[model samples]
Target: MLTCAFLLIVQQAGNASANTRNGRFIVTITNNDQPAHASLPGPDTLAPPREATFAEGRLAAAQTGAHSYVSPADSAVRQQIEELGSANTRKRVAEQDPPQSIVDTCRNDPRADGGKGHVFHRLWWCQEHGFTARATDTNGNLLGEASVNYVAIAWGSYTSRDILVELQKTTLGKPTGVFSDPDAVRFIIGANCADTGTGNGCAVHYPTVNKTLTEWGNDQEWHNWLITSDESKSTSPDLVLRHRWNLSASVEVPGGTGGPFPSPTPYHLIRCDSATYFAGRPKACINDEVLPYITYEINSAPAISVHDVAVHIREAQDTPDLTFPPSPTPKRIPGKYIYENPKDNGLRRIPEADEGPNRAVVRQACDQLRPIPSDEQCDEYPFASTMEGAASPDWDFSAKAVNGRENTRAGGYLRWYVFWDRMLYRDMDSYYVNIID
Candidate 1:
């Protein structure tokens, strides 16, 4: 029975690999809101001109018992009123006119009632930075909303160079082979925030949006991870890293503010590393150790009212049970696998001395099987060894006020680290790391 089951698993794995043509996959992220469909205004849709007779009739009603009803000055005032009303009508129509499109398909999406409503725009072939979008109402009010959907297609046999080129073209907008259908390629949604909210699900402040992306690209730790070809090479066989942004204006708080707050520009980056693997085995050997690291900078001090700022590393808690051991079990093999490294094992922390202005640089390496010590000290190292069985150790990072303050209101840079071991063959196919506040 065991042999039969193993063969079935191998067959399924082969089928999955055959389905992948060139090893290319598409990734899409959206705001979870539906795309805004509104109508464009044209020259013929202006409000009709108001009649002079109707205006004069209303004025006569107000002067029925007044003594100045038939004065010469009243006739002159009526004439001026009619002229001003006509001019005002024309001015409003002019203000409502739509701007010329920079590209052929870039135009306002017409509304159902044949009135100006919303704008639906597309951004393809980005020059620098990733694809982004923004929308506004007829009055030029930012909707602070976005939704995206996209898929990946394989054009040829998968190669690291080819995969990287496509990723840069789709994300940072590097020019590549001309795509026939720009509209079908990709989309972006961007908007400005008018104010901050005290509740969850509010608009994301504009400053936070700029700060997060800027720091992500500038931080040295992030740069090393992104540029280091060998570190993540096993997990990213095609050398393609997938990222999706979930831009939100909401946050969790005590007592639940009726709505979302815009202050923290809450966002998440979903990263996926794609490396090919066979049924229950990796195509090539990899280092048994996995190291995921994050680096951040506090650009300025927190508000005076703020008390303590902290960084937290959380890992999944589960016991490891072995069903099938290695081909040949060791004579002294233990009953169960040790899921976590010792508290003092392979831990490193380097925190810069505090300056008078509340600025410091701190780095911590926390693995899935181990937690940062209660006193937050890293002073030990242990011999590294590969695990005897497959395990998944997922971890995340969050920086905020531990006490006195409710949430972080100030701006700072933060990144998270996640590591995987070679014993788990799946890491060669894909790996994930997350950042949060």
Candidate 2:
């Protein structure tokens, strides 16, 4: 349609790839309905208005000869083929290239809707993961609030690793890509960008969303966490490396309740390497072991706050039947046995740091609770649930069935946030445990 630099909206909707739609990609193409230059009026300017008559020829050719079906923009914007006398047209077409949409399709043919008449698609075995993500924007509201619809296909994938890959790729694009702006280096893809294909977060992420951000609502429940990153920013520091959230899609109809969000599910930082695994051991061969923060949420409720506890408080208190002492025991616990490291061995106690923060926290715990089995009530807080390689370490973990959660305002739990990485004593992550009150 010709106009005075007219404005028109073209939405690339539909799946047109011969490749599987779910084949690691949601390819979108702008336009797909166009006739081949060969099918056009041969070298005739005075042919039909446009190639609108391409269907019949397309169908006929598909049934017989080999038809070259380029991109929608490319199909119409190509240099006229060396037909009877279309050299001039071909030159003009070549000089003008194709439309911006055509150019975009060449680079990234956006995935289409469930129909046809769109750009061709392919599975890009990208070394990178996080890219431009999209989502639905229709928050069904009546008169007071207006709504816009953002149609995006939701995809399930990694958050940090993918974003990291994209960052690395972006780095390659820059003069060095190793700029000093840490956030820029990390959240380059930006936040909330992961609306479409999500696992924890979008394009870019930050750990502050977990650490620094003010914990909202009450305690003893899951908390709705939100973080954003722009391709213009970095997500490394702000993002809990490997952490991810399971997302569900919801559409606010023109007349529906919007904010009583369902409970937030548990999300653990996905090992950047966890993507690849051996059947024998689920945990990949991680030399520098670092586990992501697990969502300490009960049910699907949003948690009120996040706390760090000793690794002992992560899961329910289970005993490792390895007979220690005169019976039989190992000095160190295996992380794997503690449900931590597969090669994890035995874990004892920090032996009290004598002073400083370690001693302080212990002392504080002892004072807070009056009775704890005895004086070492908080002392012998079952440093380790000790459930490695045995039917069960005949110990009652009933009272100790503490999942590191504390009943406060919304929901709170004790988790460990190790300063660095440790493969052996996987106890570094969260040392915060909730007392069964």
lDDT of 2 by residue, 184-217 (tens): 2211111222122433333333321211001111
Candidate 1, residue 286: how far the Cα is off, in Å: 11
lDDT of 1 at 242: 24
Compared with the true structure, all predictions reach lDDT values of 0.20, 0.22
User: How many collisions between residues are there in candidate 1?
Assistant: 22
For candidate 1, report its TM-score. 0.16
Give the least accurate 10-residue stretch of model 1, judged by summed lDDT. 1-10
lDDT of 1 by residue, 312-422 (tens): 211111111121111233222111111221121122211222121111111222232235445333211110111211110221112221332312321111110111121
Highest-scoring model, TM-score: 2
The alpha-carbon deviation from the true structure for residue 127 of candidate 2, after best TM-score superposition, in angstroms, is 6.7
